[model samples]
Target: MFEPSRIKNFVFVQKIIKSELMYLQKISLANFKSYEYESYVFSERVNCVVGENGIGKTNLLDAIYFLALTKSSISNQDALSINHEAEYMMIEGSFEIGESGENITPITNNQSLITISIQRGQKKAVLRDKKAYERISEHIGKFPVVMLSPNDTDVIRDGSEERRKFFDGVMAQLDSEYLENLLQYNRLLLQRNSLLKQFSERNYVDDLLLDIYSDPLVEVAVKIHQAREQFVTQFLPLFKKHYATLSDAREEVEMIYESEVGAENFTQIFRKNRPRDLAAQRTTMGIHKDDFAFEINGFTLRKFGSQGQQKSFVIALKLAQFEMLSQQKGFPPILLLDDIFDKLDDRRIQQLITMMVDGTFSQVFITDARPERTRQLLDNLGVEVKYFEIVK
Candidate 1:
């Protein structure tokens, strides 16, 4: 027989034991972005980077984002991240993972180090404790980080590809298998498109070769579609809850996922679409064409929502992302705010500060152009904060 009180106590203890937080203790940058050579020691709770425009405040946050995601957050071109006068760039961060309490202590009292570098003509490299990773993908999710920036509005205002990328990025951090399937599906899609292009050029269609490509594509697409569907279902409630909190329960917002593979036999659909795909010289029906629609008050946010409403919508999406990642990964992720104070209203900014003070978030980095304003805003929060001032 199980005693209810005892079982509850056991579960609480287990939760505490598993609630360890991971944060960067120090970071070094060489020839990256706007900095020629710089190093920063971050506070475990909050660190603010302040500078005038073009002095590299955002670049500092992007460096931390690169360490976690193994890619540049602001640009897709890795070469562009290197300083123009330098031939290569290197970023190294030391992290601590440990149990949290009145005095947070490292479980092993040892720090883990991650180093990432890119050279002009060589493959980018990522090292864990001086050992190079065989594949960069292996480095993601080990230390999850979420970034909220002015550009987040693009998820609501931009095309479907941006929305797809946003959700795909969130899903990738939460599920390694989804990342694998996404990579494989993208590869298969390229191959299928290449074959279609070749067939169009040659004026000949081989059904057998098409079938060879189609079968594997459908297999991967089904997995990707199913994973996305499951993620959206789980993500909606969290998004709604956060939106209500941000908006004081004044508006109703919804996220709708649209995919051609849903409620249909994708295999048959792929076969049926072959003729049109050949005509278009691309694979037009798959997860690649999926979209996420943002709605407020039962209408498209892009068309109907005000600037404040849109800002709240995107912030709600990011906060929900943070919560989802924390729940899935057993600890909160490092949150990055890039000039967010300029984009969000005072009320929303206070809400974020309250989260930091209440320990809902373990580590955070914020950037601002006005140092005094940043200080004034955070002073009332009663939390320890570190500030870095960038000068040209």
Candidate 2:
């Protein structure tokens, strides 16, 4: 997307990715995960992190990712990202944006300093160029990122919650309004669930008080459901296109979004299910139960697809995410590949390598435990490739 590479009859080329102008120029980490303190300068094109297994390669990638999205890719709790030897954590990144080239030095005006820090028993802080943001949500789309990992297949094979979280994250990165709606929905759901638990413990039913929480919860749930429905409609075609190109065999792939809120009787059913909800001590019916089902040839992918097929499907999903975010944000997001070379088969790895070399992506960060294999593959790519060799 960053250069005019001739697109041949390749493995995956259904769409022409646009020009990418954003890239991370540098990053520093303090008391974050495995790094007590570390800093590195990066190329504008491709970066590979090489190390032995469990030697903090993925942690380095997550630090870059944390600077982009202001959140960890693996853990949900910010405290968990803090080093065991420290009481707080900090991550800082310098990004060269608004232009595209092989320039080693970025213009001061074009560089952005993004920093995130968290202390125990305090709110995490996210800042841009030393000025703290009033709302961290404002930083969502500024530095978009897509992380592909071997465990991503769990989004397909695992419970509905994983699928919801995966798609919700994708939608949140692109749509601020949808992100706001999702946040509100989650807050309302939590409050309503607390009320249900309270009702159960007290052995009392306060219909009027319950409505106080239910009304807003249901209202926001509808909005969340609509957003998700619209997202699936827009995302499915791109996902299927990528899958077709990656698999090279069109077996009729589909992503179907199933939600209880789509039913006409959703409100009635929700009200009727209060007793059941109270018994379970949680909200039982809403967009929270929504699921995205992957299918190949009308059969459930999770149950029917082979391991390689599942990997291809999830990788396609991530690639579709990358393409969509690039189109929406007008620049390609930073791509993070976490131990994917060892996880993916030879054919898929070659396809990915070709894409990275031939300019389908910009500012890519890859993690591999095998340094020899990584060097063998990336050494010949005619691009600005840099390797951060980690030694534990």
Q: Which candidate comes out best when scored by TM-score?
A: 1
Q: Could you estimate the TM-score for every candidate? A: 0.94, 0.93
Q: Write the per-residue lDDT of candidate 2 for residues 1-392, one digit (tens) a residue.
A: 21233224322322323223778888899999999989999888889898888999999988988888888989999899999889999999898666343442233337789989999989999999899998898898888899998799999889999988899889889998988888888888898899889988999989898899898888888888888888888888878877877777657788888888998878888999988998999998888888888898899999999998899899989988988887787677789999998798887888887777665777789998888898889898887789889997
Model 2 whole-model lDDT (C-alpha atoms): 0.83
- What range of 10 consecutive residues in model 2 has the weakest lDDT sum? 10-19
Q: lDDT for each of the candidates?
A: 0.86, 0.83
Cα miss at 10, model 1 (Å)? 22
Residue 185's C-alpha lDDT in candidate 2?
A: 84
Candidate 1 stretches greater than 4 Å from native? 1-18, 105-110
